[model samples]
Target: MSPHDLGRIYRSEIEEQPAALERLLEHDAEIASIAAALQSRGPRLIRMVGHGSSDNAASYGVYAFGLLPHWTAMRDSITLTVHYDSPLDLSNSVAIGLSQSGRTPDVVEYLVRARRSGAFTIAITNDPASDLASAAEATIPLEAGSEQAVAATKTYTNTLAALVLLAAHLAGEGARIADGVRRAAEQMAESIPAFARDAEALALPFSYTGRMFVIGRGVEFATAREIALKLLETCRVAAEPLTATDLAHGPVAALDPLFPVWAIASPDATLPAVQEAAQRIRETGATVVASGTAAGAVQGVQYTLPVPAPDEPLLSPLLSVVPGQLFAGALARVRGLDPDAPHGLSKVTLAL
Candidate 1:
């Protein structure tokens, strides 16, 4: 609220994530109930839809639902309904919509259509009273409280936590997953300050850069996409996100010394392949910045950002995304831009 606090709101939201996640975990009973109701429907497939950071969270949901419940999950293109008015057969499917404000028109409309098509619809959002909540048969509150910054921080992480919690319950791994989520919150509480400071320092050198790439694999690929969005929202950087394998297939050809790459790799099955990609990128003389538990383990990284190591690799996104948020805030400050007030953006975007 003061001159010195100009850029602190976004960082404060970043710091509030541990508490936000812990708060969401307290609603385990409600999440379990929703999971039970969903399971009762005997869904044949899973469909999720959102925009921007919510979309990234949906991407994570696709992986979470598949890995935990062994369910077939896919991201639904809302444009199919909003733009083309195509008939969709979503019967025997569970459709989910994730919106921080719960007012994203496209997501709400998608859920409305899915419900009409006989799918069991669920909404994950911060506000239980939002239109998105009204569109779904069930709503899981994000419990992230109020996020004033235009770029999502606590709400985004809370969205991820909610999706994982619901998926874990659906998979019958509720207790174990709950424990992992709590432990991840504890780790985040202990490490977020250092993560913020370190990420800020790590991003200072690249403040003037116009573009870069953020890479990861598996669930962490969602982490990469969210981080890239943060950088774009707060710092006005064209931070493109790609999976490590996707990078190698063709995008790697565009890398050079002037470009920087932030490779987010956790301690999981995807680590070795991500490390290989980082090594290859380094060989191209590009500046390679890495994050996550296995960040330091990656060879040829110019800088390693700190992230709390989660109890399981599946919960890694809870910890892995902190540094990228801080990095974006710091980069905005260094460039004399207000991280909370990007040139033309709002807290809630109503897209048709």
Candidate 2:
């Protein structure tokens, strides 16, 4: 509880996740209004755009938008939209811009272009007056307050929840979505202490690991990517994010019995495929650590690091990442690195 703790800022933000999610739920009406407006537009796809943690948040939206009563979604090419200014037809599309500070020039520029191209643009941000919010037609506030950590924690989770709610509204699953959010908040609060123990133990193994792969499938794929990025930024680990299919395709060759491989196996449609991939990776003699509620179900993995189960399958990416965030912060502290102030980085960067 000392302020002098190395990763205190990052830890505090991670610990505030439940309250941040609660703030999001408080804005349900606003989110619903925007979702209704978007539905009226009859958009066929959601084009998500952001950079850094925000970009990873967009990946969650991709999964959210694809949930049953399915809708297509894709990441907008920031280079094409911002730098090259390529003319794109977006009349039948919805574009969502995500930013913590809401000041990233490239993200703002892309939102501007998407709006001009006839897309119903929306910005999810912590700062209401931020440039990205101004550029979009509507805004979803993250309500994460001020995050002093160099690495994003609260904002990422809050933004993910907002995207999920938006998706649920679009799919006409209002009541279920509200219940799911409440359950998710409770789980997040309870998981903190349990996962803290797991993270503390896992840090010892990761401290000695030179490189690793973080794998997930479906919505959890984006969860893996965010975890890998945190490990890389905070712990200085050469962590690569890959999907189960990608590992099976060719990357499987790199793992050895001594090699470190982390798998996120949640309870979802992709579980069988991801577990199958985890079993195969374990056969390669690599040290496989399976994470998620179904960690015990993934036979052959050397470690089963269980996290709190998600309330809804579509919310897997948001809940499954809790343990990974704890692991990254703890692992960085174990490695004598300052997780809150990682080198060669800032809280925000202007891609343009």
Candidate 3:
């Protein structure tokens, strides 16, 4: 197969991200109305909930929204709906549920409860016909299209983009976000090929590194987790992700001379702490690779992803996770694992 064909499955998915954003923007008026209603109500709290890649998006959303003054954002559907059965303050709350397919039972159930409890609910999903979307007060469609590969690629990026857009909307910065989205889409279009090339080259070495660790701070921490999940699901490799501070607590002991570590070191307030953690991990004699926009922050092989503009810093997770997805997909191919069908996983989880 030709190189173009070999990577076409992932490349196409990556390239379509911009178009997906365009679709979202084209529907901006409807989305903006929803945002206005939600913001006008002035929710006391904001909750983002999902599973798998969607969960990762929720995690990122929490970080992005928390940066706003007096905003209470969290990822707690599982804990609240399943474990504690706690009654949330829905009278002044907005519940955002994310799902690529909008079919997850837990997500659907939680959103239903949230809505019935009087909270404004929004569904971020690719499938407009899905149950989750039907239950939501408003649906922000993720135009990622149908992803053939079980491991999500475009959907993950689109979800993060949607969440960030939602954040900007809620914060009453719709016009600014629209501008950023356009710029980000253009930058992403230019960057996908470079990302593919860089990730392909890195995958050759990654295949041999049986075990790996991903570390990041702040929103990048969620990026690390998403990367770890992608690697584990698609590459069928044992990968772990930890927060920079959490790594120092106990996980650091697992680091050794033979391990390989990947750090998502974006330019943020936590960059210093992440840089220190990367340095400490390097001291363990592990080969390290750092990916970020900043120059020379990392000591080893560094892949600097192009950033469109200095984003809300809280929204960096949307851009940071793209490289990780590419790396995971490429590494899976390098390891002779089927990117479409890893060991034993389905495209959709239907546990009714």
TM-score of each: 0.97, 0.96, 0.92
lDDT of residue 310 for candidate 2:
68
Per-residue lDDT value at 31 in model 2: 87
Give the Cα error of residue 45 in candidate 1, in Å.
0.9
Q: Give a tens-digit lDDT track for model 1, residues 114-224.
A: 899899999999999999999999999999989988899899999999999999999999889999999999998899778877976776689788899999999999999
Q: Cα lDDT of all candidates, in order? A: 0.89, 0.86, 0.77
Q: Write the per-residue lDDT of candidate 2 for residues 139-218, one digit (tens) a residue.
A: 99999888999989889999888888888888888668867987888888988988889898988876878789999888
- The local lDDT score (0 to 100) that residue 189 gets in candidate 1 is 87
Number of the top-ranking candidate, with TM-score as the measure: 1
Candidate 1 local Cα displacement, residue 156, angstroms: 0.5
Q: Which is the better candidate, 2 or 3, if ranked by TM-score?
A: 2
**Residue 167 CA displacement from its true place in model 3, Å:** 1.5
Candidate 2 local Cα displacement, residue 281, angstroms: 1.4
Best by lDDT: 1
What C-alpha lDDT, on a 0 to 100 scale, does residue 121 get in candidate 3? 92
lDDT of 3 by residue, 1-352 (tens): 4333444565567667778777777777777788788778888888888888888777778766776434788886556774577876677889888999999988888898889888899999999899999999899998888787778877987887777777777777877877777777777777777777878888886677778888888777778889889888877678898887888898888888767777887776887887788778877887777775542576554344443333455555656667777887788767666666666888888884
Error in Å for residue 65 of model 3: 1.6
Q: Which one wins by lDDT: 1 or 3?
A: 1
